[model samples]
Target: MEPEWIQAMQEELQQFKLNNVWELVKRPDPRKHNIIGTKWIYCNKQDEHGQVVRNKARLVAQGYTQVERIDFDETFAPVARIEAIRILPDIMHSVCMCARFQAAPKESHHLVVKRILRYLAYTPTLGLWYPKGSEFDLVGFSNANYAGDKVDRKSRSGTCHFLGRSLVCWSSKKQNCVSLSTAESE
Candidate 1:
């Protein structure tokens, strides 16, 4: 890489506050634990208007290298469904409801935040793009294919609300009731 390009990339990484995308990790003690292998990834950052703004670097661990207890005790994480996200705003519509709600539990919140940080580390340059000259109209679409979930044999549907060609909101979920026929499901 050119010296100027490297310097520019370093500056951009610093601006994003992502200074630790790569670092050498001393090999873990053989008796003490398992250590995950890591890999480096690179990409270009794009602005909301779809212009390439900067080159990005990321370091990601090979999660499969982890061993139980030695590397990690638990690897499970919870993620909210789109319906849950959609309902949250509706549920909190009342001012009193917002006031009565308690903050998220700290430990869980910390774990969630840590996972997000790790994700950012692995995909530093990933972002949305809304280029100029696009249409600006409101449009929506909803669709589903029955028995989408192999575990439950349930039908699932999703809806996408768009502002012109830019997608603003979308959701996917299992239907509340089972339908005997495809027409009924539709």
Candidate 2:
């Protein structure tokens, strides 16, 4: 293996150990339970000019093999959709999830992930900008797309909260209930 890749893996293992992420225990009885597997995911971290800056290695649990109630119950993590201006973080998250489902991801997914990386390279300094002494008023804007998802025909809603001139929070998510009309979708 490449030295950087080895170093990245070592760093990941070190972090896990430092954080006390898991414990070594005897294998569970096959008749009573299942043991979830894990794997290492590797990637190259790039700089603004698209040059490789570092190597990244992540250890992820095989979530697919996990039984819903037996291995784990629920997730508290929040989900968000990609936006035009704030694209990298959300798309990166989506791509990571897609990668987990497939043993080998498709070419299209790779292209999408690469495109997001390129975009990030082009806009390395892009981020929320709040001028000093700006007003502190809180404001929010929200919108919805009616039956946006073609497969399921479900509506999507998004909202952004701003404190004065800076964005404080934002989210875009699919609606749980079917909307009869545009008004209802909003």
Candidate 3:
């Protein structure tokens, strides 16, 4: 490999080691099954203030070429609510006040590192920035359609809340049960 390429690979490996993302397990070679291929991805790392301070590298699997029910099973993942996240600090404080204070548990940090690595690898140029001269206003919109659920004939409601023209929160959820009328839903 070229010197520059070697350097980049080393950096990526180092980051992987730090993250404890995954271990490369090796076994006896098979005749001809299926193996997913991966590629290097790079991106710029920004600080909490939305300023680029470093470059990140990652190794990402080419999931698109993978066949369903073969290489992977499910790609579904549940998302946390933004409102819940915004209340986390207060919840933590309440919990602390209720009992003797203790340090927060740390388990998902490594997984988060792994996720960051994958994200950086896949979107090397992607970044977030708070531009100057931006308006300050809070706006939101929600919509729902009945009989959209194929399983139980339930409606699906979607809401998106924005802050100063920036998308900050959104959600989509199926109703608990089929609503006979829209007014009954409210």
Candidate 4:
């Protein structure tokens, strides 16, 4: 492995230690018990200009090899994306696009997600605040994309609700039925 990759691996191990990622246990008999395996996923961190910033190494489980009920009862990967809570229109668009392709995400999608996370980490004040004296004025706005998804030709619906000038709620979901025209989509 390259030096950068080694450094990244070390950092990841450090994080695992700091976060209490695992418990030390006696080695299980290979013939009696199925021991889970893990793999290292490596990626190149990049900047907006497409320049390589650093290396990122993620230690992930080879969960596909494990039996569903015997090896694990239930499986869930919990991730917290802070940008989803904020009402930044640009960020939401990027986040929504990333989520749409999360199953088989490309390198570009990964870069976009990294950018969104970095933005949220540095500049953290783009948040909605409900003040006590703020007048109650509920306003809602909605829009739809006609045949937004090129694959299925499914239209997308988005809505934003605001109390006075602060945005409170927002949602974007793909329409169930494909609409031939924009008028039908609305």
* Candidate 3: residue pairs that collide: 42-124, 43-124
Better of 2 and 4 by TM-score: 4
- Across residues 1-186, which tens digit of lDDT does each residue of candidate 3 receive? 445556656777776677675688885356575666788776566689999665555567776454443223333333211122122222223323333323554455445445545645776675557678887677989999988767789888988777788766666788786545555553
Evaluated at residue 186, the lDDT of candidate 4 is 38
* Colliding pairs, model 4: none
Model 2 C-alpha lDDT per residue in residues 1-186, reported as the tens digit of each score: 899999988887887777676798999898899777898888887889999998888777786554443223344432111111122345434544565547787888787777767756876676556677879898989999888888888998888777787665676888787745554553
What is the lDDT, from 0 to 100, of the residue 66 in candidate 4? 43
For every model shown, what is its TM-score relative to the native structure?
Answer: 0.27, 0.35, 0.29, 0.36
Every candidate's lDDT = 0.56, 0.69, 0.58, 0.72
Query: Model 1, 42-82: lDDT tens per residue?
Result: 66667899997866654445776544432224433332111
- Ranked by lDDT, top first: 4, 2, 3, 1
Give the clash count for each candidate.
0, 0, 2, 0
> lDDT by residue for model 4 over 126-145, one digit each (tens)?
65566799878989899988
Which prediction has more favorable lDDT, 2 or 4? 4
